[model samples]
Target chain A: MDPVREVEGRAYPFGLKNVDTDIIIPAHWLKTISREGLGEGAFEALRKDENNVFDRPEFAGAPIIVAGDNFGCGSSREHAAWALLDMGVKAVIAPSFSDIFSGNAFKNGILTVALPQEAIDRLMEVAETDPISIDLENQTVTTPFQDRFTFEIDPFRKHCLMEGLDEVGLTLERDSAIAGYEARQTGEMPWYAKGTALSA
Target chain B: MASKPRTLYEKIWDAHLVERREDGTCLIYIDRHLVHEVTSPQAFEALRLSGRKVRRPELTLAVPDHNLPTTARLDEKGHRIPIADPQSAQQLAALESNAPEFGIRYFGATDIHQGIVHVVGPELGFSLPGATIVCGDSHTSCHGGIGALAFGIGTSEVEHVLASQTLLLTQSKTMEVRVEGELSPGVTPKDLILHIIGTIGTAGGTGHVIEYRGKVFEEMSIEGRLTVCNMSIEGGARAGLVAPDEKTFAYLKGREYAPKGEDWDRAVAYWKTLKTDEGASFDKSVVIDAATVEPTVTWGTSPEDTVSIGGEVPAPESFADPSKQKAAQASLNYMGLQPGQKMSDIEVQNVFIGSCTNSRIEDLRAAAEVLKGRSKAPGVKWAIVVPGSGLVKKQAEEEGLDKIFIEAGLEWREPGCSACLGMNPDKVPPEERCASTSNRNFVGRQGPGARTHLVSPAMAAAAAVTGKLTDVRELR
Candidate 1:
């Protein structure tokens, strides 16, 4: 993961609400073992339409998406996140986001900005013809038209996005603490460590 | 001095907390990690590239469900048949190799133990009361029915859990979805949850864990509770929990992985204390009258686009918000539905009576009961019943449910998540509508351009018989 401090570009002004992961990337595209080359399949269903905004020359390869409320609302397939990154979506600005999708996006260094619908309405307007800029460090989304809207994010996630921290590696540093907890659990609740040995 | 009365979620959260950071993020230990073919191949690849082994292989279980064909897997000579789709074959092959390489136990594609991860977990007692379970698939919330703190994770988090048993997390707020009153006959748990989701909308439980409370849930069978909890993701909750009770213990008593002898008694003692303390506070709450819930079905692409069997399709203009109105119009277009059309008047070409949501033995029995002495209507082109697992299929066979289904003109197929997401060969053809017992009604979930109307098992059977959506109550 790369440090993601700022994402500034023309945003795909797709304001469809409840855009689920299935729409982001369908199940057929999920068979690949690798994460690369998913850009071709990103929004494959919507992209089938010749006039879809994603395929429009102005929004092609845009690094941001301005969507309606409850964006990325179904399925836990991280392929949705990987597909977005593969297609160069660095930030998604929505009024709200589903919890799992938001977490997946944060993990992949994609910034998710939640602002009031009024701010989103303004962003959607500016996104039609102008570039939108998101600053993770300052927790703000700004437009070239001098419009600035602030957002909220977990402080830890912000730090992680800025630093490009490897979460698993960091947790491995606390290996001793985990081992200690396991030791305690073994004594207190020994049944947990008993593996599910199926009877023949 | 008395401690603060805590919710069941808080109690489980406290028990699993390993460390809390200054930023308010906590490292919580995952007790069980379930892996499947689709979301796990990439995670294993990442692990191999990073030269990291599974931190706790004993705690992990892998099975190939998604991308697996529910068709016959063996030849007459008892040789294994190859998967038709090359990409799917490779994905399944990767898990077959990765599990053994990482020292994790895997139920192979043809193993009697192999099935949907959610169904396999509780049936084998791999999921237990008060455990924290994580899986790459969203329906992992189904394990919460057994009183676990379970939620779905993405491939990145799947890799994280593989490399380390703990995950960096923030605590979720608690919500109580309390349902009172007795459920009317023929109103299944699937209908109850669909009605709940219709009331609360898809984003209703976002950022919170829901604890189902009151008499309705208490009387529901473990399978019924599992069906309700399975769609918690569709409702936007991270997980849904029902506190462990005597029924939960009874359901687990002699299962393969449940504690034994003295351990069983001790486990039960601990599980009994897993309930919410009286007067515990919830961040939010919603109450539903169970008797009011009807046999429900979805009318549009989204799960929230649901109505009772007797209700009419809502007009797009009926929505107050312009965005919603636009969405509703699009959904109606995709679903080929007209406003004011009765739900029962809509015809379906396909009927799928299986998924992690409703593929257990109980669900099969319910559908079989409806299909007995009946056959598929002439207009219904395809109808199939896929059990959740091999064991579930065996149990259904022993009970002669397969005969009932076959006699009624529905294909009694092998076990896998067939036609649910259409990763396999089973799929509802484009532009065709299906009455599905699966969780999601999202566009293309059953296949590209496939219109899915989510319904319960019995309701799906009813549709199969009538070749249209029919209220099960009216079938009698």
Candidate 2:
């Protein structure tokens, strides 16, 4: 979980709408136990086209994806986020996102920027030729063409993404409080605290 | 003056709030966490790498359902049938080893208690009223039917819950769907939910937790309630609940994980108060006449792309939005359907009657009732019935549902999420259309290039016998 203050690179100009988790990475590819090397299978169906934008040399190693409204609509598989990160997608700019997908992306240090559809259209146009830059500190996406668009993100999520603090890190911050709760739980609800009692 | 009345969602949500953060997010205590094979391996691996053990293994339960083959594990001589695919084998193996290592209850491939995570949790009484539950699968909302505040979480959140037993969540808006009046015979909960999803597109319930109410839901059986809540994800809702009632308590009373004796009375007293207060308001409210909802089926790639069995496919020109028209056209092309074609006239090559959505004992009975004396059509190549769990399978067998299915020429198989996503051996061939009782009619969802039409179990059974998406009422 490396800190990400900014993401500066050419973005894949695919603004496809209703692009589901199944399309991001097919179910067959989810069979693997490992999360690594998933980029090869990322967008496997769309990549079947010889002239697919993902295969385009210009957008290779792009750190951003400008997607359409309601992106990542189906499934709670975290592999969708993992696949994007594997393919170097550090941020996704869209009009809206599936809440589960947004949470997954934030947990993995990927920024999901929700902007107006007009802003997304402008960004899509800018992404065609110039590199796009995202400044988490300023909450704006800028293009080499001097186009700028602002976005809103929950402050807590923004802080976590910028500082690379995952849920594990946050939980550890409250270790003492958690321990105290567990001690009380063991005393009050012994049946719930005992692993043997629950397994039955 | 009276305080502001809160919706059922608000009441349950407020009860679970442990801490309110400065960022307007709150930490909610998670009473139960469900895990399956497909999404949890990486989460467990992350925990291993970080050298953190499960904080409360007692609260977490792991099961392998997505990757398990829907066939008997033991053969004639008690020899185990081999898992052909290495990937599926590895995932099940990972769960078998990981659960014990992590000290969580593991229902493995051979465990009779093993089934779809969503089905087994409620069947075994793990999901309870007024509890905050999370799982790594979207259909975790199925538990909310029993009045729990439940929704899906990602693998990362699964790990978070494993380490802390709490989740940081921004509160969700509340939606009320009140379906009044009586349902016509042959109109099941599956049809009702499909109608709701079709009325409110796939993204309609986005960011809202829906509480289903009114006379129709109150009269529904627990299984019916579960079926309705199971597809809440299909309607784009974060979760859907039907508040705890007598039917819910009756269903859970004797289950293994249910509280007993004095604890039972206390639990019931608490659950009795889980309903919405009188005159409580919601962020959004919609009412439907349950009697008006006919037997429904999806005609396109999305769950919202649905229509009544007696209706014609939607013409792209009918849509005002160009994007929706384009999407409808795309769906028509992929489904090999014409815009004006009647849904019942479109033939299907396969029929699947199982999934977390509609694979309970009652679901099996509904399909069996339709197929009792009927035979599958000659054009139908394959028809399969996979129960939600071993318990469901045993119940169906005891009721002679398996005999009915077999006599009707439909294959009765073991329990697991077979043919739902084609992770197992069962799959609809490419370019073929299937009438499936499973959720999700996405193109290539059952298999690559496969077309799926979502329908109720009875509708699927009718289709199996007719070779098309026929209305179950007509068949009855």
Candidate 3:
């Protein structure tokens, strides 16, 4: 994962609510073991229209998406996040997001900015012709028109995004704590670990 | 004062906590991990690239469900049939090899035990009360019905769990969805959940874990509870749970992965303690009259766009908010529905009676009861019943449910999430409306240009017989 401090670029002002993962990448494109090349199929259903924002010339390769409430509401497919990143999307601004999608976005170094609908409406307005900026350290989304909106994020997630930390490695670093817990579980709840040995 | 009463979720969270940081991020251990084909290839590939072996292989179980074809997998000569789609074949092959290489137990496509990961977990007793289960699929919440703290994780988190057997997390606010009174006859668990999602919009339970409470849930069978919990994701909740009780213990006893002898007695003793204590508080609460729930079905693209079988399609202007109105209009357009049309009059060309949401033996029996002496209407071009797993299929056959479906002109197919999503060959044709028992009525969920009306198994059977979205109660 690359460290994400600031993202600034033209935004696709797609304010559609309840945008699910099936629409983000669709089940047909889930066949590949590889994560690359998914941008081609990203929003394939929505891209059918020539006037679709994702396919329009002005928003091509846009780094941000200004969307409506409940963005990424269904499915736990990280491919939705992977597809966004593959299409050069660095951030998504919505009134709200599904919990799983938000977590997936953070893991893949994509900034998910949640603001009030009024702010999202304003951002959608400014995003039509100008680029928007998201500053993770400041927790703010700003447009050139002096419109600024502050957002809330988990302190831990914010730290990881700024540093590009590998979560697995960090968890592994606390090996002693994990081992200690396991040692206690063996005596307290033996059945929990008994199945593993039988399988082995 | 007595110790602060805790919610079922809190008890599970405390039991699984391994470490906590100053920022409230807790490293919680995962007891069971379920894996499927669609979302796991990349995670396994990442493990290979990083040279990290699975930390606890026995805790993980892998199976192929999303992309496996539901057709026969063997020929007259008993050789394996090759998957037609090359990409899907490669993905399935990857899991077949990856699981063993990483020392994880896997049930192959042809294995009798193989099924939808969510369905496989509970039936095999891998999902237990007070356990923390995670999978790379949204419906992992299905296991929560058995009182486990199970929720879905993305592939990156999938890799994290595979490598560490733990997840870094913050606690979610708890909600109680209490449905008092007995559900009226003909209103199945599917209808109850659909009605709940209708009451609470798709994003109603966002950022919270819902604990289902009240007489309605307490009386529901484990299978019914699983059916209700399976769609918690569709309602925008991280997970949904029902407290473990005698029913839960009865469902798990003597199962393959369940504890034996003294362990079973001890496990039950602990599980009995997994309920919410009196005076326990919830961050939010919703109460619904179970008697008010009808034979519900989704009217449009979103699961929240639901109506009772006797209701009429709502006009976009009926929605109070501008955005919701626009969404309603768009949904009507996509569903090819008229604003004032009767829901029971909506015609369907196909019928699908299976998915992780409604493919258990009890579900099969429900559909069979509706179709016992009837045949699908001639106008219904295609109908199929795909069991959740091979074991479910065999069980249904033993109970003569397969004969009932086949006699009703419905295809009794092998199980593996068939027709639930468009990932496999079982798809509803373009422009066709389907009465489906699967979760999600999203655009193109069944196939491109396919319009799906979500319903219960009995309702799906009713639709097959009538060639329209008819109420199961009406058939009686």
Candidate 4:
């Protein structure tokens, strides 16, 4: 799922707001749960018009999607992120993401690159015709003309994404912390103690 | 030896807290993995690509409802047309194909049990009280109605849960949202939540877990409780929970996944302590008068942009915050509605009374009761009822609720998350207006250019009969 950690690539910007998951992979496409066949269905509605973004050859393989504020809202369907990923979108630069959508993106190793609307607007302008490069380690997005745009990401999310650690991997790292917490909770909060015959 | 404090949420949170990190994210374990067709494909593929099997296949339950078509493919507005595109067929096929391979118990299109995941999971009892459930669907929090610490997980999280049934997360602060007093006739849980959202505004519950307490919640039915908690996210709450009691146990008894005879008492014991303590504290509190909560509906895009049936859409200038002026104007324009218009005058082309948020047997019965023997209003193009679950559909039909709907000029359809953005078959056409029982009214939420007003089922029926939004209480 960790396709790439460092975002040193071109950003393709689709500046739509409140992009619900269904539009990402229309429910019409949800009849099957396979991944390979999804590319055909990704942005099917948008592709219906000959003049839409996906049909334009120049933006065909855009890596960065610049969405409007509150993008990816509604229904916690995670396929929305998968469709973007499968369509070759490595990062989504939006003012904000739905709480659920952001989590899904993180788990899938997709960077939910939240940037200030002003900063995103600038990238959107540059990305429309020119490729913009994002550097995760340095937290900057640089253009061919050497213009630099910096963004903020949750440091821990950055660390996990950089290290390609999924939740399991992250959890294993805290095995000791979990063990300690359990020991303390059992002794102090006996009534809260679980996993005995209670679940019988 | 000092011990840690335990609240019901904390106890559940702690048991599931697999690991704690220096940065405050907790890698927590998920006990039950409820899968829906909508978000499982990628995760299934990830499992395949990684050469992994489901860590606990038996603990996983799967169902496909969001994307199923209620009617064969049609171009009619508001009617659920089957998805005929090849790609859609492929997506559904993949889920059907992969489910058996993983040994996950799955309910499909023709399955008598197929329905919205939130509805099926709790009814099936897989999401038992005190258990931790995670699904790749947001309304996963609907399972919280049973007092489980259930929340929506994403596909990557789905893969994470599959490999180890755990998640890394930051915990939310606790907030007690208490609604007291008795609701008047014509009011329902849908209205109650609408009223709460309107009062608290959409962002009121941000960063918090709302625990519904007090007399109103106590008197609610399992279905009613589910409706309130279902839209907690719209209120910006991370999740919402209700403490389990006899009402909860009664709902679980004899369910497919609930404890059988020998396991019942022990199960109840574990469930009893899931309640908050007498002196326990919450980071915040919001109290409401249940008695005053009338049949409510949304006049604006956000759930918070709601008012009582008799109220008017607020003018942009009425908003104390100048920044809200643009949004008010945009909502007024997009909805094809005017500010200061009495909600009673808002015309509706369709009334859809089903979704994960509403569409329970009780919700259907309520709408049917209002629509009984009444013909749909002229110019009201469509009126349909899509029950949330197969079980609800079965019970409603047996009770003759379907006949009432039909007699009153409404089409009754099979169970699914119909018209709730889980699928497109039931969407309202762009530019048309619909009074929907679904949870959201975001732009294009129902369909492109579709203006949606969220309402209770009875209110929806009222709108269907009047061809415009009207006070349900007047008809009652």
Candidate 5:
């Protein structure tokens, strides 16, 4: 599923640190409990402000968001990821991301690119002027001014994103290995081997 | 080759090993999977798209907390705070849909049994000793209060645990936090832990699993042990542990999920040996005197920046390190308190006496005793008392603690993460300072620009009446 070419997108910049899931999408929005319509709640509190980052006219319809370090530091709410995706954030450029938040982003087709502080600062500047292009196949982000920065992603996530595969898809690819393991473990750990492996 | 006698960690770990990696991390089989509504949706989807079934459905349990509203059917039409935050509702929907599909137990809103996952896990005996339990919530470590090797996992790990009841993890080093002597009368486990964090400076136990030992822990109630372990993360420890004893067995003896019949006898016998051996050495050791700990409150953003009830707020220059001094000054300005003001005299706008931190029945009772006949200040907007668990909530109601909160003009609500950072419905307004019993007072965690002063339940209750950080010792 690894692509020979790169995937690219526009840069939507959000320059906030310690941006928690609660802020990404408030909890009260969780009533219907469906993933749909979550994008509306993305940055609900911030959107409430007249001058919030998401409401900036200059950054309208931007795809890539360049953010500060420690972005998404609190809560394990995946809706934060869903809402961001629905809002058209294809990739997030940041100094760092909260571990759980980053994983959720990657699984949901949003690329969480970790760049050095200098790289983020430069990207933020470039994003304000024009859109940035990220070639996932090439593992590089490029601007018209010839500024280029390469980012690394886990090979597994890279493969999935290239193929639009989720974690379930990735695991499905390993069916043969899983089946083989189950067969082997049946005798190794009988407690897990009862009936069909499905029950175990 | 001779090996050391196995501790509970060794026994459970050895029993669950599926494979050992060259790097020394074991592919450890997880025995129990407890999840909250907030973190399970993505994992559930991963399971669905992969066409995988739960490795053990019966072993997994789910509950809606974190983001469930304290006031359902609340009006949002021109309300100050949005009545419904759509994202949390969606997350809840995902759980409501998937739990039944996967055959996992789902406890939702006001369900006589719905509460904080960790609180309910033990009360129902779902968190047994010598078990490997994984939850996406960081406070999952609260289960470690009963000698379980429970740890918080990421969303990806949550997916892993769902598809397969196992994780590949490196074993952690053990750190023993010994709290000795009897606690001072007004001093509780909440103060004891805040004192530990204040002394240890937040990152003291990073990368190590802390086992709280000594007389203070032994004498502490189960609810108290939970409060202590709940904040272990504040000190940066992965989790906290307490070896199971008669107290642990007594708490679990007749719980809903506890082993019945002869299995009960065997489970207790096995649990007794879960403790560390006399000669067993730990990677690190720290000891504190319980009698010396007083009512504590955080003076800065981090949990470590705490002082005693009667102590004056620290001046920036009091910190010798230049960077710390600067940060202290910055925090003081952000909190809007004078550097030299008496710690016990800072005014607060609200009083929050619950959360996973100190929302047990005993915690409510402790707070209610102080608020029994007293009413809070009129201008204080909210006095939130969200219980930690349905069982605890029921117990408190039976004891009329709910009436006490009501009589004091406080709002008595059902269990949920109410004002805790896990969600944001019942939050403090920006720039408003409040006394809270929850762990962590990171900038604006209570709400956007809301200031939180972390204190014990007793102190938080006292502040409810006086509208300031009054000493709980004075109330007595």
Candidate 6:
């Protein structure tokens, strides 16, 4: 995965609240074995209306989604994040996010930026006619009209994102410590070992 | 000197902390990781591509539930089987192939232990007190009933745990919810939780881990506790936990994975200390009168859109928040309900009694008790019961719960998360309203354009009999 220092593009001006994973990508679309091409199914229900923003040609490759509060509120489906990424959504501006969904988005290199509702409202307006830019390095979101909003993020997450480090890569960095712990665990709890204790 | 107070969540959380990072986040080791067919395939594929193996395969268990078809035929060796849906077949096949490749244990559809990941973990003793558990499914919080620090994770987190056996995390603030008094007859744990969700709204528990206390939770049966903890996500909580007691120990004793002989005594000694100490504090607190909770049902698109069975549908204007008001109007339109319409007057074409939330043996017995010698209403088109696990199915059948449901015109089917997710053949037709025992009422959660009314198993059974969302207490 490439480092995501900044994302600059027109954002989908959708400000709908509690836009759940179901609305992001319906359960039926989750049936496919491959993760590729989910963009076609992204917002499948909303895109049915010809006038919907997802189908609007101007925002076709928008790299950001400016949504309302409690975005991604249902289901632990990573498909929601996959759909967003496939649709080229590099960052989501919302009042808040469901922790599980935010975690999923983070792992997939989609930045979830939480701002106050007023800030989200302002962004929603700016996104309607202007492009938006997000700088993860500075923790600030800006619009072509000079609307600037600074946000707070866990510094560790920001570091990982800028460094293009995933959990696996992070863990492998501490491989020696993990190996030591595993050896101790095996010795102390032999009953909990796989084949010896429970039939798998 | 006075000691600083700590919640049960903090105590457990602090115990599992491996390292505190410079950025206010910590690395916490995971005791157990559960995997399912739907969310894990992509994670496993990522691992394969990266050439990384599971760090601790023994600690992870895999099962197929969400996309499983419950009405499949038996094969030559007496294994219940179905794979007609090509996509479902491929997903399950991927899990089967991937589990062995990574040395993670896979329980296929044919295995008796194969069930909903949450249910199988507890019934088979994989979830234990003081353990930190996670899964790719949100309802993984269900194991917190055993006093474990359990919550859901995304597929990437699943891959992270598989590769490192730990999650890098930021902790959540703690909220305490105390339910006082005794529940009214015919009201179950499901009613209590739905009542709480309705009171708090869907996002009320955001950024917090909720601890359910008071006499009601203490007195609740193990299965009832599981039912309550399973829906914590619907309340927008990262997780919900109950301090384990004797009932918890009794439920685990002698189970397949539970400690044995001398280890049992030592384990119980430690589990007994897994509670919030006296004078401990929470960031927030709420109190619910158990008597106020009735046979609850959701009448809208979200779990928070719920009310007592006898109550009237709330008008959108009743909500103080404008966004909530708009959401309520949309929900009312989608649910095909009118403001001020009594919940009891709304009709339902189907009654589905199964999900990770309410598909256990006790849930089956509750519905069976209501359906005994009673036939479904003539207006009801489809009434079905899908068990959570094969063992639960076998237990229900042995106790004649299946016979009662079958006699009542409700189809008693095999074990899996069937109509709950609608990933398989079982589905509610478009525009048809259903009284469901599932946790979610999200639009199209059951099927496209299918309206869902979240109700308890007993109420769903009663609805099957009366063809509307009738209060079980009235029938009693």
Off by over 4 Å in 2: A179-200, B1-3
For model 6 chain B, the run of ten residues with the poorest summed lDDT:
B72-81
Whole-model lDDT for model 5 versus the true structure?
0.75
Give residue B192's lDDT in candidate 5 (0 to 100).
88
The sequence of per-residue lDDT tens digits that candidate 3 reaches over residues B1-476 is 86899999999999989999999999998888999888899998998898888988988989899999999999999899999999999999999999999998899988998999888888888778889999999999999889999999999999999998899999999988999999998899999999999999999999999999998889999999999999999899989999999999999887788888888898889999999999999999999999899999999999999999999999999999999999999999999999999999999999999999999999999999999999999999999999999889999999999999999999999889989999999999998999999999999999999999999999999999999999889889
Report how closely model 4 matches the true complex, as a DockQ value: 0.27
* Per-candidate interface DockQ score: 0.74, 0.55, 0.68, 0.27, 0.14, 0.56
Off by over 4 Å in 4: A1-71, A83-96, A113-135, A138-155, A166-200, B1-6, B72-85, B320-323, B422-424
A86 Cα displacement, candidate 3 (Å): 0.6
Whole-model lDDT per candidate: 0.93, 0.87, 0.92, 0.77, 0.75, 0.87
Q: In candidate 3 chain B, what residue range of length 10 has the lowest lDDT sum? A: B254-263
- Give interface RMSD, per candidate: 1.5, 2.3, 1.9, 5.2, 6.3, 2.5
lDDT by residue (tens digit), candidate 2, B1-476 = 97678888898887666678888998877788888888889889989998988888878888889988887888899887889999899998898899999988888777778899889989988877777878998888898889988899998898889888888899998899889898998899999999999888877888989999988989998888888998888878879999899899999887877766766787788788888899898898889998789999988898988898899999998988777888889889888889889988999999999999999999999999999999999999999999999899889999999999999999999889899996888899998999999999876789998999999999999999999889888876
Model 6 whole-model lDDT (C-alpha atoms): 0.87
Candidate 6 lDDT, B1-476, residue by residue in tens: 97677788998888677677788788887888889888888889989898988888888988988888888558778775668999988998889998999988788887788889888999888888878899988898888888888999888888899889888889999999899899998899899999999988778888899999999999999899998999898989979999999999999998877777766787788788889988998888999999999889998999988899889999999989999899899999988899999999999999999998999999999999999989999999999999998889889989999899999999988778888876888899999999999988888889988999999899999999999999988888
Task: State the lDDT of candidate 1 residue by residue for A114-174, as single tens digits.
Answer: 9999998998899899999998888999998899898999999998899999888899999
lDDT of 5 by residue, B2-97 (tens): 667654456566656666655565567666688887667767886787688887777788888887777643345733233366667667777888
Clashing pairs in 6: none
TM-score of each: 0.99, 0.97, 0.99, 0.84, 0.78, 0.97
Candidate that beats the other on lDDT, 4 or 6, i.e. the better one: 6
> Which CAPRI tier for candidate 2?
medium
Candidate 4 lDDT at B204 equals 70
Evaluated with DockQ, which candidate comes out highest?
1
